[model samples]
Target chain A: MDFLTILNNSAAEILSPSTAAFALATIGLNVHFGYSGLLNFGQAAFMAVGAYAFAIFTMQVDPTATLGWPMWLSFVVAVLVAIVAAVAFALVLGIPTLRLRGDYLAIVTIAAAEIIRFTVRTSDYSAVTGGSQGLRGQDYKGDITGLNPLTGTTYGFGPWTGTAYDTWIRILAWTLVVVALILVWLLMRSPWGRVIKGIREDEDAVRSLGKNVYSYKMQALVLGGVLGGLAGIMYVLPRAVQPDNFATAMTFYIWTALLLGGAATVFGPLLGSILFWVLLAFTGGMLSGLQQIGAFGDMSGTQAGQLRFVLVGVALMLLVIFRPQGILGNKKELSFHV
Target chain B: MSETTTDGTAPTATHPLVDGEVAPGCKKVDPIVVADGVIRQFGGLTAVDVEHVEIPRGAITALIGPNGAGKTTFFNLLTGFDRPNKGSWSFEGQSLAHVPSHKVARRGMVRTFQLTKSLGRLTVLQNMLLGARDQRGESFFAALVRPLWRAQEQSNTEKADSLLARFKLDTKREDYAASLSGGQRKLLEMARALMSDPTLVMLDEPMAGVNPALTQSLLDHVKGLKDDGMTVLFVEHDMHMVRHISDWVIVMAEGRIVAEGPPETIMQNQAVVDAYLGAHHDTDLGTLTNQQVAQIHEAAEEEVPVGLEASATETTTTDAPAEPGATAHDEEGKR
Candidate 1:
């Protein structure tokens, strides 16, 4: 029932690596749904691929994995593997479906992401994926923490404080977010962005103009999926590569983050992710605190936890109803349709 | 009738467009696009089934057909947007069969859609710039480096600015295209197509949904294409537009080229008049009284198909599409 602790924890989420990871995923989704108008409903699948690939490479899942590689080599190769796998997945999903329409891609992507989650969680792959148990955070933590150049044990001021290792991950994650922001901004500002946006509004128009709508859509899918893979890598850096964490709901959370901020803007994802995490933490903390103080009557801790999602549903409806273009979207230009 | 409806801006011979006798699938003196055995089907419906058609070079040719004669489908096939069942088309003598739409555009043939596809979210300038071909910045990796595409982008922007001004859309350059009226959207779509600098520009019903006030300017813009030494092919329902600007006219009915000749000849051809245009084409549908409509309907009852009656009725009264509506209204008045 400690309000101070709840407030402090909620504030701490603003700079957390998880928030950064969510921002990264939202940024990638922005590239897909916001700019290219590709409705990718399976962003969680990309995160799964990146997380599992990076972890499996680091853990040396079996003897057949890249043998005798150093930790840094494993990490780098793991990232590359994530990127390649994401691109491959994008191609698999895009080649047949991108030509169909936005909804078809959404359907295929959601199915593909769910398949990835189920396959990884199945007992058949328990030897490598750890099944429902998931790999321990300690196993992957060593590689990244060992590479941390910062010597001091504790870092940052006030409630923003973290261990040297945590600070290192946060720094790296935020750096990626910044780099992704710049990349999106640069691309969107260029003539390439003009074509991508054109495809978003009308692919046929872009096609008639001779810009290869299919190719542009594929590129956008691959580009966004690669970023999603990178986000996955960063997401699991501090946590276990849990299969359950990358459920369909994970993809939706990323979408919520994207829409909450503004899908097509440069810093909208970052701002949204931070705000989402902060508000989520605040709401969850407040609900749990209220439950503990008997405000919920006989409601259990789990039921109290479920109430925050109801709030999310309400928030999403309000967002769509009031500001479909989102916080940073231009009211005149970027209104949501479908 | 004049041999060429082309205005006094420049002098060009009219009959120089056709090579042989005026007929369906006739040869052009210099054909920019030649299609052989182009066929497209959707279930039982053969949308486009052209045997042999040649688009004349450096001239404005109008493709005129009734509603379902597959004019847009033919345009789609030629532009490589949609594939034909078993035909080959060459744009500027380069075989464009199975080529992707963008490549078809790169090979110097570009098109516009029947329904204006102006990128509503983009500014007018952005929509125009997207039409330019072979930009270094359009590539994904090269776009990251501003220096690689900045000069080209600048020049493309300038080109786009000029086109917008020419289309009288310069004032709306900074505005989102969604804010534009229906006519402006059509103009923007055409201007955007011109950005590619194509040798052959195919405009699919460029006048559809356009305001009549802007139609003349749009007509001038299409003429301007021929003036710039580019071949202009357009699909339009307006016969006046076809007769006023087109050097040649290719008539399609039931997915086949029914006739091809100078605009003057196509207008005179008996089969062309019967298949489309109709015998009463000179009589304004709107001006016809109910008695006049009934008289025309009774006289042409055996010749005109039920489809043409619906279309004729559709033209006369926008809301009441059938004689049943007129009869029902008469019953209401009697009651």
Candidate 2:
């Protein structure tokens, strides 16, 4: 309940693998909503596909499991499978919805994400998907941890300290985030980016210019979703792969992070994700410390735990009102649209 | 043939534009685009029902009509922006019916929107660059490696720069297209369309919101397209612009082609005079007498006004009314 301990806990969230995962996912959402003007409200579905495909496929390498694939082969195939699944999801979602107006995509994506959650949680596919309780992290984390190069009990210094496994996961998660950032940066400056941005402004105009607007949009959707899938894998790396984790609220949280950082900007997602988690952790720590000291007059830990999100909601509203274009977005470019 | 272009070239389509008698659905000496039975209906309203239309290659053909005449809808159908009830169209002799707008453009036919659809958030240069065809950098995988597309990007930038310079938009290249004036945006849109070196150009109301002086420059640019041997088809309410720049004019009324001919004779066409154009179609709005103005208003009360129905037909060098004596000089100078 010490204030120093509270501050330390909040700071630790900045470098947490969870922060990296959300950052990666928000970057994917940025590609969807920010650059392409696509409203993908089912980003969590893309993440879910990644997590499930990776966990299920990697689990196949277990000697007792079916197929009994080699560990190395399973590792490579799991990543590839995640990517392919994300693409298939994109094609399915985009073929019918991309031609429609922007709002339709938003509706379809949100519905699709929910459908994915429900379908996976249903008892019918419980053996493969692990049902509502979901697959345990220990089942599949072994491959990634097996591949980890770090060989120390503990790592890092001071407030950023973590076990070697934690350090390895952070490295893996951030490396993916950096790669995605670089890819997005390169794309936005190219003629491909110009065409995409033009579609954002007006598809008719881009179409008149002879660029395949639909193809470009599909490409963006798949690329962003693949990144989302990777983020999904990252999200569950340090914990369990619960079906409830990829619920509608997860998609909304990614959106909040994207808007907070700047939807169209290169570093906006990373910044937004860091700020969102750090603030959430900080507020949660403060509230619980107060609760332990009887500040809420016998407020239960569960009740205090939920209060931090209320503060986050308030912060998000304030952020939207004051800086809707986000920290890094150009006011002239995205202020009206964002 | 002696008509000097802005860049000192002669007009390419000087021999003859039509194969026979000038009429609705008339055969062109060389048509870049040919359409038949393009019927588009909006529930109770028939938007466009052009039975046959041919756009002359390497010449500026003006498509003019009053409000609700379906000129834009026909433009949409031909450019593959809208679907027709039943129609067959060919661009450069290849059938293009049901082709998407981008494919229609890829066939070397590009269009500009009547509302001037400039990508507002994009820089003026970026807007122009988006019009370039076969851009290697525009492919998703190719975009990642700068080396793969750097040479093409450089060449494209150069081409874009020259087009911007030609449109007099070079100064605003780095500025976002949204920040441009209405006239500048029109100019930018036209320049962007030219980036692909299209064989056919379709413009919808390029002069609707432009200033008159800019209209004059836009007139020169359209003329320049013919000099470069690119076919130009445009929708314009500005009778003056249509008469000055267009080599041929096609008039539409109530979703059908009413008449087609050179603009000099279009005014004298009996069918055009009755079905659509006002008697004072050629008269400058600034020069209209109070009685003539009242007649236009009176006509509006009865039905759609022949001349006054056009929005901003008088956008010119000055909003100040022209002196009575200047009208003759203005008409003569345009001729």
Candidate 3:
């Protein structure tokens, strides 16, 4: 591919429906770990719920034949399932662990996410879920492709041009990101958001004021999880419903995005996600170009991919040690001694 | 007429005229809180174990005790900040024994911390806004409709600003709460408690660590709570503050109320005296009495020339008007 072609492909991936899903998920994580100081490590569970619920529902719409259910219905079902799963997960994890210190909750949530992933991976109902191999060839493009004005024709506005599917997913994904961002921004500015921050500072003081600190925390967790679920649905839209796709690494990536942008601010997650993807793409592209010219010195392509993670890890560690507040996070907010 | 009763138990009931003062206003009146057989034990220690206690409505009552006396624990229980091993109390006529702390605040009862608990990162105004938490502009749906939530948030902010002004903190309203002086923080905490429009306000050591220059303001602000028809319950170690302002005083020692009465009567009571200054001292309830605490405070005030007169006023109350220091020591020896 030419340099332009390479850049265009990278841009396409960054602006894809999948990227939108990750962005939204990271935003929700911002609410959890960023704003409220919750240590949720299983954000992917929320995604799994949304994606699996939508995919399973869509599949069930036709056991013998396609029920031809509208894609909008699937989206709505996905969101609702995500919300319910989030609330349930929050109650289960929150009740026993929220009252404990922060580290314990972090462990529980991470373990819980793993358990959820493994459970889905090993379940006997392999036919509906596609077992360990996972579901494949999902026709998510049917509705968007058909409705596109350029469904059967090439659409070009400038040097940039793409098929209807690519354009449609970008439009839908970005619209969701904007809406979720707005929602988070408004919610954080609300009185309820104040209580969550208060809970972060001092639960005793908040309680003394007659506010339910525990309940406020649970609500924040659920809200963030629901957003994560929306991201999950978006995550699997362009691809198949695969259990391995909802990996622990994905949650960690979301966290990386949140920290890179800012935790407390709504715009932090969006900016962080974009920066992360761009950096990853740049690193990958540089390594590949070097490999083609035998400029690796001794590094292999696989090693380069792993090296990208190592670089990201080092960046995160430095961020935590030197600037735990993240790029946009307030230093004062980071000092929650409680 | 009789110093000793027929049973020879030092008549436990009459000499102090102020004993009956807290009773008249409370006769046949409905109590806002009634704690019966409440007990809190930690390891081998009992933090609070009151058999019976009642908090009158629309009045400022002080819960006084020395260190380790469970005053904080009782405040915690009443506000649902902690769960007592055993105790049941009510707010208004409602049984608040099982109700959560936030629900307690929602039911028009709000409290401040003994140590100020302001969110440091947020501005003083933002902290104050957090206090007006029950305002109906927080729902997700309401948030989407900007006009409604925006108006409500504006009104809340305006109200918080007015409260800040009343507390003489208008100049620092935009500053971070952590940047505030100790006295200003005390003031901010009090002002924030009022943001919820609570009917009952509980202040835990509101005057602790406050400057003498601001003590009177804190006292007056507390008094103003009662004037505004809000019930005030506070935990304080300052007997003079309790005497000067409290309508009723409940003395706690080792987690139980040893005496309950008006300030004047409670101060002179043998039991109240024994709770303080220990059991071996003579009846020299003079400067060594409430005045000693004020005197310790006065010593701290000598550095500020501006508050010299206020400190003198505090001293003059402990001594004869003509000879402040001489009479103060003399009074300390004479009870």
Candidate 4:
């Protein structure tokens, strides 16, 4: 492809429905790990909940296969299911571990996520989940596209501009992001947010203030999880619902995005997601070009791709060690002493 | 053998005549919190073992003792941070024996920490807002509808701001709590505790790391809690501050109350003296045992002028005459 084509494709990838989904997912992660300080490694479970719920309802459960229920209703139901699933997970994990120190909660959550993944992939549930082959025909593009409010044809002056579908998803995804960010901002500004932060800092002190530390923590967990699940539902909107799609890598990517932007800030996750994808695209494209030019004797394309993660990992480690507070995260936010 | 028999029979014979058969008790008053046979053990060590203790209503009560005296543990038990091994306590007549920490706060009882717990990353105002956890729209559905909770949230912010202003933290409202000085953080914590609109406020070492300049202000703020009809109970080591602000005092040593009385009377009690000042003062309880303690009590009663030296110092200067410890203050201050 030409330079302009390469750049345009890269831009499309960065602004695609998939990117939007990941961005939303990262935003949810921001709520859990960044804002509430919950080390939830099962964020992908929420995404799976959303994807599977939406897929199952439309594909198998609903009376109609092709012309299913209203997309909005389906979206709502899927989100609700994801939230319930998240809350259930949180209760199971939080009940036993919230009383203990922080690391136990992290371990339990990660394990719960693993269990959830394995359960969904089992032979018994394969009929519904499609197991390794995974469920397909979850594309809501045509149905959702019909509902679009756009009245005019797409206008593009140059190669940089994209088609109607790209614009639609971009607008919708960003809209969701903006609304979510605003709600988070407002909640953080409120008295309730202060109590949550207090719990984060010193739960015992907050408890002494006649505040219910556990209740607040539970609320934080549920709220963040629900948001994460919502992001999950949004994630599968344009893609096929598959088990591997909601793998552990998704969680790590979201964490990377969140850290890159700034964990606790309002715009941090959004910016981080955009920057993360942009950098990944540029690196992959450059590495491919180098390989095509025979920069190395026999460096495989897969090796080049994996190197991107290594670079990002090193950057993340360095960031955490030297400046744990990300680009937008406040240094003060990092006072949890260990 | 006859003399030993006389010694034992003498006390028994004198008990009825001297009216010392029954132990005296403080006049019964409304208790903010009452712990009955409370006991908490960690591993093999019993951290708190209180037979009975009552925090008087609408008064400042100081829970004082030396280090490892289980004061913090008692605070934890009372607030539901930890469960007692065998005990029952109540706040405002409600049994809080098994209530959780958050539920304790909802029951109109709140507490501060010995180590300040201001959310370092959060702004001071945000920290205050957390204090209003119960006052907001807690329902998930209710939270999404901004208008339903906005007015209430706005009002809460306004309330938090007013509290910040009252505590003279208005200027630091936008500043991160971690940026505050140790004293300011203490003020922020106290101010945040008030956000819950609690009826009883428990402070754990409110003056531990406070500067002398801000110490009196903190004391006055605690006193203000009682003036506003809220019960104030605090753990403090500063005896002067304790005696000045505390209407009632409960002295703890080794996880048990050794003495409980009015601050004035408590200072004179032999048990209180031994628990607080130590056995070193036992030498003064000689031929004039009662008289010297009475003299010390009378001297302590004459409050030294405000901004003047402490009564303990003035007494050492005026009464000790030729003792080496008489110059103890001057020597220490010079060093």
The candidate maximizing TM-score is: 1
**Could you arrange the candidates by DockQ from highest to lowest?**
1, 2, 3, 4
lDDT of 3 by residue, B28-126 (tens): 154677788888999999998988788778778899878999999888888777888986777777888977788888899888888888777667898
Give DockQ per model, in order.
Answer: 0.54, 0.50, 0.32, 0.27
Per-model RMSD to reference: 7.4, 10.7, 12.3, 12.4
Lowest-scoring 10 consecutive residues by lDDT in candidate 4 chain A? Answer: A137-146
**Off by more than 4 A, model 1:** A61-70, A334-338, B1-14, B277-335
Model 4 stretches astray by more than 4 angstroms: A1-3, A65-83, A138-175, A321-323, A330-338, B1-27, B137-166, B265-268, B273-335
- What is candidate 2's lDDT per residue for A1-338, written digit by digit as tens? 79998888889989899999999999999988999999999999999999998888777555324666665666778889888998999999999988888898999999999999998899999888889989999989776787889998999977789988899999999898899899999999887888888898998899998888889899999989999999999999989999999988899899999998998889999999999888888899999989998999978988999998888789889988888888877777744332
The C-alpha local distance difference test score for the whole of candidate 3 amounts to: 0.76
User: Superposing every Cα of model 4 onto the true structure, what RMSD results?
Assistant: 12.4
Residue-level lDDT of model 4, residues B95-206, one tens digit each, is 9999877788888888888888877877787777777755545554455566777787788889998888888899998888888999999999998888888899889899
Q: Considering every candidate listed, which one attains the maximal DockQ?
A: 1
Candidate chain B TM-scores, in order = 0.79, 0.78, 0.76, 0.75
Q: Which stretches of candidate 3 lie over 4 Å from their true place?
A: A1-13, A63-79, A95-104, A139-149, A153-161, A291-296, A321-323, A330-338, B1-31, B277-335
Residue A246 accuracy (lDDT) in model 2: 92
Q: Which candidate, 2 or 4, would have the higher DockQ against the true structure?
A: 2
List lDDT for all candidates, in order: 0.86, 0.86, 0.76, 0.73
Task: Pick the winner on DockQ between candidates 1 and 3.
Answer: 1
**What are the fnat scores of the candidates, in the order listed?**
0.88, 0.88, 0.60, 0.50
> lDDT tens string, model 2, B80-134?
8889999898988999999998889998989998998989988898988888889
